[model samples]
Target: MSLLEIEDLRVTFATEAGPVEAVRGVSFSLSRERLGIVGESGSGKTMTGRSVLRLIRAPGRIEARRMSFDGIDLARIPEREMRALRGRRIAMVMQDPKYSLNPVMRVGRQLTEGLRLRDGMSARAARAKALEALEAVQIRDPERVLEAYPHELSGGMGQRVMIAMMLIPEPDLLIADEPTSALDVTVQAEVLRILDGLVRERGMGLMFISHDLNLVSRFCDRVLVMYRGRIVEEIEANRLSQAQHPYTRGLLNCLPTIGGPRQPLPTLTRDAAWLE
Candidate 1:
């Protein structure tokens, strides 16, 4: 059986104008493999990830014919149980480190929280586990990083710290929402490589959300292209060049070629029916 399954999932947010449908009729199954969700902003990739964890706020609604993780019905699971599942079974690495990290807390304290709660290790053991996790993410100065405040770290450092916190639990499924969107290209590559390696090595299911189609195609085994909250196309990663949907095709054409002749890229045209 798949690790996670989502069927006809829809989410609506209350607005002054009216209720806005953020996700519509999205369905997919995840195995111990990398699955990419790519879409422009407001296309519901983030919302879908949040909904699976039952993290949606009031006035926002989620509806799915069925949503399950490892044969357990997520929709039927109690919030308390869901809380236990979160960070322990299925973990999420949010988009930005600046907003995710606590300024007042030391990085080591935060990493140890994951180890303590998820692994039930002793305080001293948690501290050691935190250092090990920090080292696993290639942080050379794990001791210093543990003692330093969040504000003391660079963007890349903070992100690696976030990665360590998320992975310290050895979760079976990972949901990373543009985890490298804030870093430099080199740092971004490093973070992605670390995550990809962890997923492959541990045989964990990954729900990789991003706007960069090329990167997703290269890193993920399967691709799901979402537009205006609905999944418009699903394709094997290597065959992304042959995507059938117009939205997917447009997204590919929109990427600036590395050495190709300079030309004004075509803008993506929207179709009202595509959202229906």
Candidate 2:
């Protein structure tokens, strides 16, 4: 069965002007593979990711014909039940680890918290698992990292810690929202490599949301190009160069060629029809 399925999914916020729809009729299915949702800021990619986890708060609401994970209806489930599903069954890795990690908590404590609570593990077992997870993410010194706080780690280290925390639960699906955006370019690739390896090894479905077209195309199995609250095009990652949608083409064109002659990059031109 598909790991996740959504039909006619919509998200709207109560703005001063009126109810503004952030995601409109977004629909897709995922299995044990990486699926990339690419778009610019305010394109609804992140909102869609959060909505899948039912993370939208008051003043914002989610509506959908159907939203299911492994045949269970997510839209109809109670918040309490949804809480059980989240983190254990479905986890998310955010853009910045500093904001996600607890400021005052020791890294090991935060890392072991979920396993202890959810898996009914003893403190010693949880710590062992946490250390193992950190090792899996390629942390140089898991012992020292466990004792340190979030503020003591570098951006790249923090991000790896976040990924390790998410992986500890062995979730069936992972929603990574711009997870590598804050890291240096070289560090970004290393983080992705670690994440990619884990996802493949675990056979977990992945929802990778980011604005970097080239990165998404190379990393994910399939690509969904979202524009202004809707998916403008869906294509295989390898065939991204042949995307039919003008918006997709425009995004690809904006990427500067590595060895090509130096020239001013082209600006993207949007059509009013795309917002329809």
Candidate 3:
């Protein structure tokens, strides 16, 4: 069975313009492999990830015909049970660690908080686990990093810490929304390597959401191309260049080539039929 299954998932928000559907009848399944969701900023990639954890706030509503994780019905689970499953069974790594990590809290505290509070690990044990997790992500001087504040770490370092904290629980699935979008090419490669290693070693399903089609094509096994609020096409990562959808083709055309073209990049043309 798939690690995660989502069918006809819809997310909507009430607005002066009436109800706005952010995610329109999306359906997909994930196994113990990397699945990438690629689209523009308003394409509902992030919302789909957040809805899996029932993180949609007031004003925003999530509805689905079915949403399950590991045989458990996520759409029907009580809030308390869902809370218990959130960090221990499923984890998320946001795009920007600066916004995800608490500025006021020390890194060590944030990393160990769920371990101690949710898992009921003792302070010493939690600290040890936190150190181990930090090390797993190739963070040198784990002790020093644990003592530092979120703001004290560089963008790359902060992102690594976020990955560490999320992995500390050893979740069955991870939803990473643009995890390396804020870093340089070198740092991004490092972060991707760490994520790749963890996914392979732990056999965890990963839902990687990103706007970078090239990166997604390289990193993921399967790619779901989202346009507007729906998935317009699904293709093998290696065959992304052969996508038949017009929107997917347009997105691919917009990617700047290394030594190929020096002229102006092509503008993406939109079709209203894509929303239907």
Candidate 4:
């Protein structure tokens, strides 16, 4: 069964000029697989993911004909019910770990607090669970990490901690929004490996949101390209280079070739009526 189902989902912001449609009729389903959503800023990729969790702020309104996860209707669920569903059944890993982690609290307490909230775990049980989560994310000296403050950890280490905290709930679906964007290349690769491992081992559904086309093509099973508030193309990861849309083709060509001829890359030109 599909772990998530979204149909005709739309999000609009009440701007001063008028209603700005951020997401227009975007829909997709995910199972035990990695689904990549890629686009430049203002392309509606992140908004779609946020709308799924009803995370859109007050000025932004989300409307969907149907939105579901695990056969439960998310759009119809109450705020309290949605809260219950969020951390326990579905989890999100935001772009920056520094912003997500509390600076004042010790890492161990903050990490275990997630488990306590969703699962009502005892302090002892939460600690054990936190340790296990840290181990799964390949953090060395999990006990030491637990005792350190967020400021004491490196960017990679902080991201690993965030992943551990989110995974402690054993959520069925994981939405990672540009999870490695703030890190260096090496750290990005490491973070992806940890995410890949968890998704593969647990057979969990993953919605990986990013603008890194090359990485998305390699790591995900299927890739969805967004432009101007719509999905412009969808293709298997292996077939990304063969995508038919002009936008998709341009994106693939724009990627810098490693150790190959070094030259200025051509930028993408937009067309407003291509989808028509």
lDDT of 1 by residue, 1-276 (tens): 899999999999899999999998899999999999999999899999999898899799999999999988999888899999998899999988989988898887888876676567899999988898888888999999999998899999999999999888888999999988889998899998888888988899999999999989999999999999999999999999999998999889877788976889887898787876
Q: Which stretches of candidate 3 lie above 4 Å from their native place? A: none
lDDT of 1 at 121: 83
Greater TM-score among 2 and 4 belongs to: 2
Candidate 3 similarity to native, TM-score? 0.97
Q: How far is candidate 2 from the true structure (C-alpha RMSD, Å)?
A: 1.0
Question: Clashing residue pairs in candidate 3, if any?
Answer: none
Model 4: number of clashes?
A: 0
User: Tens digits of per-residue lDDT for model 4 on 1-276?
Assistant: 688989988999998999999999998889889999999899999999988789999799999998989989999989999998787789999999899999999999998786687568899999998899999999989999999999999999999999998888789999999999999999999999999999999998999999999999999999999998899889999998789998988988877777966778877887877545
- After superposition of all CA atoms, the RMSD between model 1 and the true structure is 1.3
- Candidate 1 backbone clash number: 0
- How far out, in Å, is residue 40 in model 4? 0.5
Runs off by more than 4 Å, candidate 4? none
Supply the global lDDT for candidate 4: 0.91
lDDT of 2 by residue, 1-276 (tens): 799999999999999999999999999999999999999999999999999889999799999999999988999999899999889899999999989999999999999888788788999999999999999999989999999999999999999999999999899999999999999999999999999999889999999999999999999999999998999999999999999999999998987787976888887899999977
The alpha-carbon lDDT assigned to residue 56 of candidate 2 equals 95
Q: Which candidate model has the greater TM-score, 3 or 4?
A: 3
TM-score per candidate, in order?
A: 0.96, 0.98, 0.97, 0.96
lDDT per residue for candidate 3 within 9-111, as digits (tens), equals 9999999999999999999999999999999999999999999999999799999999999999999999999998887889999999999999999999999
Task: Please identify which of the two predictions, 1 or 3, would achieve the higher TM-score against the true structure.
Answer: 3
Report, for all candidates in order, the number of backbone clashes. 0, 0, 0, 0
